[model samples]
Target: MDEGAIEIRQLRFGWKPGECLLSIEAFTVGRGERVFLHGPSGSGKSSLLGLVGGVLLPQAGEVRVLGQAWGELPASRRDRFRGDHIGFLFQQFNLLPYLGLLDNVLLPVRYSRLRRQRCEEAPAIEAKRLLAALGLEGEALLSRPVAELSVGQQQRVAAARALLGRPELVVADEPTSALDEEAREAFLSLLMQRCRDSGAALLFVSHDRRLAEGFDREVALSALTAAPGGVQS
Candidate 1:
C-alpha cells in the first residue's frame, strides 16, 4: 500500500473533562483511496473529522496527515498546513453569502500560497473549470451572490471550492444529506471523479449506506469508538 494519506493511532478526544467522545486504536486511509466513513446521527463522526482535519487535538495519541504529525505543529502552522493540504466540504455548504460564487471558490488559493502554486492555470481559470465540472456555468452564474443560488447549486459551489488546487486529502461531512436521491448520486459521482482526477484521498462521512457501494473501503465510526452510550461532544 502507498503511504497513508491519513493515519490515527490510539486516538482519544472529548469536549469536556472525564467524558470521552471517541477512541480509535488505529485508522488509516491510503493515498488516492476513497473511504466511506459510516457515521450515524449520534456517533462521534464529526469529532473524528475535526481531529483528522486538525481542528481538534487528541487528548492522547496522534493524527498524521501525509506522514506529518499534526500535534507537533503550532496552531498557526497547523492552520496553514490544513489550508494547503486538505479540502473540506461541510454539510451546510458554508459559503460567504456576500461573495460571488467564483470568488468563494477561489478562497483557498488566497490563504495558501502552496495551493496557489499548485494551480495548473491562473486561479480564476481553475475556479471556472471546477465550477463548470460541477455544472455551474456562464459568467452570469459565476458573478451572482451565493445567497441567490438554490441549495443544490450552493452545494455544487461548495464542492468546487473544496476541489480547488487539488489538496491532497478531501474531507466531507454528510455533504449529501440535503440533496434528493438522484441529486445525491449525481453529486457523489462528480465529487468522486474530481477526487480521482486530482489524486486526492477522500474521507467521506455519511449515514447513508447506499452511497458506500463504490468506495474503496467502508469504516464504521461506531466500531471505532470505545466510549459508551454513543457519546458525541
Candidate 2:
C-alpha cells in the first residue's frame, strides 16, 4: 500500500469565520500516482493545492501529505518539511530574475539538506543533467541571469527546480496555461516522465479537462467536494 500519498478525512477549509469552503469526506492519492484534478476557475482548486502543500490550515479534520499530517508539525517544522519533501510549481514560474538558471534550479538545496546531500555531484552537475533531460540546452543562457531567458526557457528552468531534489510530492497549478497546444503536450509528457523517473507523486491542478487525459488518474473537484454544505459563497 502506498500510504505515503495524501489522505484527507472530513477535510474542511474556508477563509472568513464560519465559512467552510472545501468539504471532503475522504480522498487518497497513492505514491507514483499522477493525478490531474480539474475544476472551474472559482472552485477552490488552488486553495485545495495550498492545503495539500501545507500552505493552508484546515478548519476541521486533517490533511496528510506523504504520511505526515500538516497539522502534526510545528509551524517552523512545517515550512522546513515543505522545503525538504515537497516541490510546488506555480504558474508564475517564481524564479528570481537576478539569479542564474543554474542557481535558480539549485535554490531548493540551499534550504534543504536532504536534497543537497542526495544531489551531491557538485550541485551544478545535477542541475545540468536535469536541465538536459528537460530538453533545455545552451550553457550560455544557463549561466546568464534569469530575466534574460524567454518564457518557455524560464518554464523549463522552473520544472528543473521543482524536480531537482526528487521531492516526494510535486504540486503544479496551471503550469501549462501560457503554452500552445504542442508545447503543452510536450511539457506535460516531460513532467509525467520525470515524476515516474523520480518516483514522485504528482498532483497537477488545472481547469482544462482535455489536457488531463494522459494522467494516471483524473479527479474532478465537483465530484468530491461540496462548498461548506450549508455555507454560502
Candidate 3:
C-alpha cells in the first residue's frame, strides 16, 4: 500500500463567491505521522481541516485521503468514508449531553460497521479500555453525564472517542485550548501516546507555539494560504 495518508494538490476553497480563503499548491501527510498545524485566527485553518475531513470540497484541485480522492465520492459516500477512516475531535468536544460517556465513545461503532469490525473486543469493552487509557475509569465516571465533567475530563473523553476504532487519521481542532498549562501538557502526552499505539496519523491544530515541540512535523497554514493580494509564502 502507498504510505501517504493524505495528499492535496493545487487546492482552493472559499466561502463567498469570489473571495478565496485558502489556496495551496501541495501538501502531504504520511501514514502514522503526527503533525502539528499552526495558524493564527482567520488563517483558514478550520477550512483546511474541513476539506481534509470531507466536510467541505475544494473548488479546484484534489483532496485525497488514504489514496481515495474525496471529490470523486458522492456526498453519502464521502460521509461514510469520513466515518470509516477519519476521527475528529472538535474544540467543543461535541459530545451528546444525554449519552453516557461509554455510549459517546461508542458512537462511531454504531455508525460505521467498518469501525465496529476493526475492534477485537466488544464495542463497550473497547470503549472502557479507551476511557481508562485516557484516565477516566470506574463505573461512576463512565455513567456520568458528559456535561458534568470538567473541561479537561471532557477533552479526554473526546480523545477516547476519536481513538476508539483505530481510525487511520485523527484530526483534533484546538483540543487543548480549554485546558490549563499543566493539564494541557498531560492531555497532549496521553493523546499522542494513544495515537502512536493505534498507528493513527494525527493532525493537531492550535495557535499555541509552546505545544508544537514534540510533534514529528509542523506546518503553518499561513505559509500555505493565498489571500487576496498574493500567497503568504
Candidate 4:
C-alpha cells in the first residue's frame, strides 16, 4: 500500500508571470512525522501549504498525496481530496463568527462527504470530544460564540477543528503567534499528541526558530531552490 506522505517532484508556482514565488525540486513528508519549516516573511511558506492543500495548482511537475497526483485530479475532486486528506490551520482563527464554537469546528463536514461518513460519531459528539481533548470542557462554553473566548481558547478550538477529521496531513502556519511561552508549549504538546494519535504528518510552518526544536525534523525552503522558475518531473 502507498504510504500517506506528501511527495513533490519539481513543483513550481508563480502568481505573476516570470517571477516565481516557490519552486521545490523535490520534497517528501513521511507519515506520523512532525516537520518544522522555518521561513521569514515572504518566504513562500503559505504558498507551499497552499500547493500541498490543493488550493493552488503547480506550474510544473507534480504534487502527490498518498501517491495520488494532485494536479491530475479535476478541480472538484482536488478540493474533496484536499478536504479529506489535509487540514489547514491559519494564524487568524478563521472560525465563523455566527456559528458556535462546536459548529465552527464542524465546518469541514459541510464540504466533505467522506469525512462526514467516516466520522466515528455524530459531529456534535466528536466536536465535544475534541474540545475536551484540547482542554476546553465547560458545558456552557460549548455553545458560546467564539468572540466571547480569549485568543488562546480560540487557538485551541481551531486546533480541535483542524484535527477533527483526522486528515493525513496537517498544515499549520504560525498558529502560536498569539500565545505566551507556557501556553505555546502546552498547545504544542496537545497538537503533537493528537497528530500522533491520528497518524498525521504535521508540516508546521513558523518564522520562529525556537519552535523548530520540538519537531522530529526540520527543512528550510532555501535549500530547495535549485530551480529559479522551473520544476523537473
Candidate 5:
C-alpha cells in the first residue's frame, strides 16, 4: 500500500508534562488527497499542523510523513526533511516584508536542493510561472515589494511560495480567514487546482464550515483528537 502523506498513530502531546494538548489514536491524509479539517478555536488545530510539519514532536507514539517517522530523525534531518517534503501556508501569511514577491516565493529553493531540482525550469522562471498561475503576472507586480501588496495579494504570494516546488504535502492553516466569500471561493479553487496539478496532498485546517465543500473528505478536529470534554478556546 502507498504511504499516507501524513500519519498520526497513537499520538500524544502536551506543552507541559502530564498535560495533554492532543491525543489522537489515528489520523491520516492519503497521497494526492484534499482533506478539510475543521474545529472550533483552541482545539489544538494549529498545534496539530505543527506536529505534521515536523515542527513539533509528539511525546509518545509517532507522527510520520511519507511513511518516515518524524521522531526518529535528528533535529537537522527533520528540518531538511520538512524543507524537502512539506510546504506550509501559515495563518499569518509569513512573507518577508523586505523582499519582492518573486524573491519571497524563491526562498524555499534556497534551503532545499530537492525542491529546487523539482522545478521544471530555473527557479526564477518557475517562481514567475507560479505567480502568474495565481494571477499575479507581469513584471510590474512581480517586482513590487511584497510588503506593499494588499492582504489578498499577499495571501496569494504566500500560496505561491508554498506551492513553488511541488512539495508532496501542503498544509494550510486557516489560509482564507481574511478574504470575502467570493475571493475565498476563487482562491480555494485555484489552490486546489494547483495541488491537483502537482499531485500534492492538501491538509487544509479551518473553522469556517462553508469552505468544506469541494474537498475529497471533511473531518472535524474533535473527531480525531481525544482530549478532556472542555478545553478553553
Candidate 6:
C-alpha cells in the first residue's frame, strides 16, 4: 500500500521555546485526499503548513510526509525532500514579477531534478498544459509577465506553478482568500481537479469555513490540535 501523504504525532511547535503555537497528538492526511483545514486568523494555519512542508520543524514529535519524518532529515536534505515531494501555494501568490507565466510554472523543474524527471513531456510542454488547464491559455496571456495579470489571474498562475511536475502533496495557504465567492469556488474547483489528475493530496488552509464543502474532509486547526486524541484518517 502507498504511504500516507502526511502524518503527525505528538507534535509541538512554537517560534519561542516556551510559547506553544501548536500541539497535536496525532493528525494525518492520506494519499490523494482533499482536506480542507480551517481556523480563525492567527490560529497557526500557515505555521502548520510550514511544518508539514518542512520549512519549520516541531520542537517535539514527528511530522512525517510521504512517511518520512521531518526531524530525521538534515536541513539540506529536508529542503531537497520538500522541493521534490511537496508543492506550496503561499498566500501571497509569490510569483516573480519579471518572469512570464510559463517561466514561473517551470520554476519547480529548475529546482528539483526529481520533479523535472517526473514530467512526462518536456518541461515547457507540461507547463503550458497546466496553464491551459487552469484557464490561462493563449500565447498573449501565457507570454505576459505575471506582474501584469490581475489578482485572480495571478492566483491561477500560482496554482499552475504549484501543480506542475505533479508533486505527491500540495499545500495551499489561504490561496482563495483574496477571491470573491464565485471566483473562490471556481479556483478551488480547478485546483482540486488538477490535484486529482496528478494524484496529489491537497491540504488547503483557509480561515473561511464556508469554503469547506466538496473536500474529502474538513478539519479545524483548534480542534485538531486541542482534542485529546488529535485528528486521524
Assess candidate 2 and give its lDDT.
0.85
**Candidate 3: 10-residue stretch with minimal lDDT:** 224-233
Q: What's the lDDT for residue 63 in model 5?
A: 97
List the candidate 1 regions with Cα displacement exceeding 4 Å: none
Angstrom error at residue 187, model 4? 0.7
Best-to-worst TM-score order: 5, 1, 3, 6, 2, 4
lDDT of 5: 0.89
Model 4: lDDT equals: 0.82
The CA root-mean-square deviation of candidate 3, after full C-alpha superposition on the true structure, stands at 2.1
lDDT of 6 by residue, 1-233 (tens): 57799999999888778667788888999999999998777777767878898989999888999999999999999999998999889777579987778888899989899999999999999988988899989989888878788888888888888888889999998888888888889999999999999999999888889989899999888887863332221
Cα lDDT tens digits, model 2, 74-189, are 99999899999888887765698878788899999999998887784867899899899999877676677888776667778898899888888898888888888888888889
Off by over 4 Å in 4: 227-233
Clashing pairs in 1: none
> How would you encode candidate 5's per-residue C-alpha lDDT over 1-233 as one tens digit per residue?
49999999999888778878899999999999999999877999867977898989898989999999999999999999999998899767579888778889999998999999999999999988888888888888888887778787888888888998899999999889888888888889999999998999999999999999999999999998888754433
Which of candidates 4 and 5 reaches a greater lDDT? 5
The residue pairs in collision within model 3 are none
lDDT of 1 by residue, 124-201 (tens): 999899889889999888778889898788888998888899899999998989999988999999999999999999
TM-score of each: 0.97, 0.94, 0.96, 0.93, 0.97, 0.95
lDDT of 5 at 73: 98
User: Which stretches of candidate 6 lie above 4 Å from their native place?
Assistant: 227-233
List lDDT for all candidates, in order.
0.90, 0.85, 0.88, 0.82, 0.89, 0.87
Candidate 3: tens digits of C-alpha lDDT, residues 19-76: 5778888888899999999886666777888899998998888999999999999999
Q: How displaced is residue 202 in candidate 1, in Å?
A: 0.4
Residue 167's C-alpha lDDT in candidate 3? 98
lDDT of 1: 0.90
